[model samples]
Target: MLIGDVARRSGVSARMLRHYDTLGLVRPTGRTVGGYREYSAEDVRRIFHVESLRSLGLSLKQIGRALEDPAFTPSALVSDLIRQTEKRLAREKELLERLHAIDASTPTDWQEVLRIVELVRELDSPSAARRQQAVLARPEDVPVPAVLLAGAILTEPDTHVAGALRWALARSGGDGVATLRAGAHAEDAGIRRRAVLAIAEMPEAPGALEVLTHALGDLDTTVRRHAALALGRQGVAAAVPCLVSMVVEGCNDVDAAEVLGMLSLDPGCADRITTALVDELASPTADSATRIRLAQALVELAGATGQEVLRQLAHDDDGDVALVATALVGVLKERSLEDQADGHS
Candidate 1:
């Protein structure tokens, strides 16, 4: 077959076939009297083989080796190609995300586009300071898109930078709530933790309550505690059990106690919160320290139930718990007297 006929039948351009010959990738097996390149049946088959290998992302050099080297094994090379393809896909995905973030920002001009691009680069910078500065130093005029901030908070390992990113996201007027909601359900505990922390700071953000509520059931203890505290502050009674557990476990128990106190202001929650505290104190496994923590938490509750629980705790078996409960009862009595005096005045 002539090279032209092979090109026509095989879809390999003649120009490319000549280049393949120059590279010794596929040389025509015959020549006519005019000295034009000619291809035999075997040569045309080799051309198809070269095109087939190229389709799998093989480099020309690799393809040459694959075709010529008897010892060349394709398994390793194919694995390497897979790795390379995966890396390329990752880079493309990152670029696409960056573009989406920029478009979401709705930049008004080239300068704003450049600024958004620079901010995104800074957010992904290796240096923690640079990532933090990317969020903190973002010019007031060039608002960093909420999606960018949401993405950063989900992956930021630095505590300070994460806090700053959450602050920026909260101020984005809840635009990133959906991203955060997705993060809240991520299989990665760290991502879920970051998502809940960010959402906690944005209590007023749309869907923040729902995401936090969902996070309350997370398997991660830290994620659940943060969600519980945030929910408690939002006046969601669903947090009461976790908040009480926080007190019982001595995990940020003081803050949990404070939130419980605030929750007691709602008349509906007062008895339930008091009962949870009293139950923990009454548990057979309750040690002196655990009982003492529960005793202190009771002081934060409103209505007489908490005081009655405290009064009963004042005579508890554990001397330390009894002392603490007695002190709290005195404090509650003082508070009640103060309330009475103010009313009379």
Candidate 2:
């Protein structure tokens, strides 16, 4: 086959075939009477081989080494090609995400497009300060899409930046709840924690409550605690068990106790919350510290059941528990007297 026929059949352009010949990648095996390049069957096969390697993202120089160097092993080169392909894929994916975010913003002109691009770039910057500033300094006119903020919060490692991202998402008026719902179920505990934290701030966001309720069973303790606290504040009685557990485990127990107290304001939930607390105190495995924390949490409750529990705890075996319980009892009594006075007024 001549160069023209070879180019036509192999899908390698004539110019590229000539370039390959110049580089000794696939030289013509013969010449015709007119001195044009002619390719034998084997030469055409080599052209196809080069095209195959090129499709795998191999550079011409690497292809030369791969085809001509008998001592070259493909294992390391193939691994390198895999890494390069993966990097290219990652870049493309990032570009696609940026485009999607920009499109979601529905920019009206080139200037808005540039602003969205710059904001996306800053959000992905290596500097935490730059990322934070990008979120904070975003121009009021250039509205950021909530999905973009949701994606940022899921991957943000910096506490302050994550907080700002969550705030920005919340300010978007619950638009990113679906994205956050996916993040809440992520296999990465950190991502799930971030998602739950962001969702917690958007309590009124559509589907936010459902996401929190599902996150209550998260394997990550922090995720469950945050979800529980958020749910409790929403007056969801389902959070009572986790809130009581937080008190017993001493994990943000004070906040958990406060939320539990708020939940107990519901007449329907008061007895259930009180009973859960009393059960934890009664557990044989309950250490004095756990019992003491539970005792303190009881003060947040509204009913006489909590005061009765405190009164009993005041005479308990642990002197520290007894002392704290005694003080709490007096505090509850004072609160009750104040309630009576207000009722009279």
Candidate 3:
């Protein structure tokens, strides 16, 4: 092992080991062609023994003498180590007993701890989607709501879970999409939130967009956020006006960001979105970030007229909105117009 690894293992600094080498207490067994020192397993054993002796209040000089092959009998060293180890074991056993007593008296929350450990294990397990699906299939064994929520959470970190989430989501609607919509109307907020999250993962799932919009209008923030996230995944510009209207008219900053994410995929649809943002930009209801995100979304969607529209928007009262608009203008201006827009068109 190298000096650092040895130092860390033996509780001796690498510098001290080099000093030990100078005193002939321990020396590297060999050197590389480039002259780097190397130690063998034998050297490690010797160094560790020296460190053990030093910790028990022996001087380095005394440790060196004790470590020398001829200076001390092997039986003497073995006996000393056995005595030290027994004392250490006695102290450790006392601590462990005290810990066990406290655990028994305090009512261990091992159930919660086990649940968390399982959750972490689920995250690390291969075929996690399948594992979640297996969990979701048995409502009698696993709480349906927790299993459903777990499946939804899995879909975000893993694409493989998308299919599993869709399976659970199908159970939400008779088809999953329809069920999620029904859940949105359910008296239980957890049902609605989980439903929204599940539906959002499968953007192309039938009736997903409509359910998401309905959820956005729901009195729940989490549902609205999931709706926005779903729309972004859907990448359908037809939903832009609805998103913009929600942002300009709604109170949540988070929802606006989600809708803007939708714009990233359809950069050709900006002009349609700009009309909506411009109307909202003048309103007291719209915030700077909201307006800017909408403007950026527009530029991304309307790559054709994005640059020109952005330049025109630069002088807008909403400074952040104008900045994003201008940046989009720069991106659109550099593209090859002939390649993207043919003369026949």
Candidate 4:
């Protein structure tokens, strides 16, 4: 076969076949009387072989070595090719993710597209300051995509950056709670905690309350405690038990006690919370330290219920408990007199 015929039969362009010949990758095996390049069957086979190897991402130089170098071992070259391909694949995947995020933003114009692109880039920046700035720079009216924000917040490890990201997500006014729910159920404990923290800040977001409720049962005490605190402030009675448990475990007990006191203002929760405190106080296994903390927590509860408990504890065997309760009783008495004086006036 002549060059044109070889190009036609093999589908390798004439120019490329000539280039291959020049590089000694596949040379013509013979020549006709007119001195045109002619390819024998074996030469055509070599051309096909070169094309096959090229399909595997082999460079022309590498293909030359592969076809002509008998001492060349493909195992090492093949391994290198695998590594290169994997790297390329990873880059492609990252590009695809960025594209998807940009597309999801639904930019109205080139400016919006650029803004979204810049935000995404900053969110993923290696510099923590840059990431923080990115979240803080978010416009109040233009919301970041919830899924993108969720992804960034879940992976953010820096304390400041994570907090900023959470604030940004909260302000997005989107259904970020559903996106965060994915992180809440993540296998990574850090991610789960981060997700709960972000959701805890979003009191008004749809489904946020439900997410916090579910988080109260998380195995990580930090998650449960944070959820309880947020829910407690939001007046969700579901947090009462967890708040009580935090007091028992001595984790954030003071804050828990304060929130519990606030919850007790509700007539419905007053009796139940008072009873829980009284039961814990009367537990035989509770040590003096536990009893002291519980005593202080009881001081947070207002009205006769808490005051009555204080009176009972005042006579207890533990001198410290008695001393603390005795002091609180005086404080409650002064406030009660002031209240009476104001009412009478």
Candidate No. with top TM-score? 2
How many residue-pair clashes does candidate 1 contain? 0
Taking the tens digit of each residue's C-alpha lDDT, what string does model 2 give over 1-345? Answer: 898998889888999999998999999989999999999999988988898999988999999999889999999999998998899999998888888877888888998888878888888899999999989887766688888899889899999999999888877653888888999999999999999999999898888999999998889999999999999999998999999999999999999999989998888899999999888888999999999999989999987788898999899989999999999999987987998999999
Question: lDDT per prediction?
Answer: 0.90, 0.90, 0.61, 0.87
Candidate 3 residue-wise lDDT, 178-201, digit = tens: 435666677877777767777777
Worst 10 residues of 1 by lDDT: 170-179
In order of appearance, the predictions have TM-scores of: 0.96, 0.96, 0.40, 0.76
Q: For every candidate structure, what is the RMSD over all alpha carbons to the true structure, in angstroms? A: 1.5, 1.3, 20.8, 4.1
Q: For residue 343, what is the lDDT in candidate 3? A: 57
Better-scoring candidate (lDDT), 1 or 2:
2
Off by over 4 Å in 4: 1-97, 137-146
Worst 10 contiguous positions by lDDT, candidate 3: 141-150
| Tens-digit per-residue lDDT, 135-209, candidate 4 | 897777665876678778888999999998887777665566776898899889899999999988887678888
Output the better candidate (2/3) by lDDT. Answer: 2
Give the alpha carbon lDDT tens digit for every residue of 1-345 in model 1.
888898899998999999999999999888999998889889988998999999999989999999999999999999999999999999998899899888888888999889888888888899999888778876666688898889888999999999899888877653888878889999999999998998898888878898999888899999999999999998999999999999999999999999999999998999889888888888999888999999899888878888888888889878898899999999988988999999999
Positional deviation of 280 in candidate 4, in angstroms? 3.0
Cand. 4 TM to true fold: 0.76
Off by over 4 Å in 1: none
lDDT of 3 at 97: 40
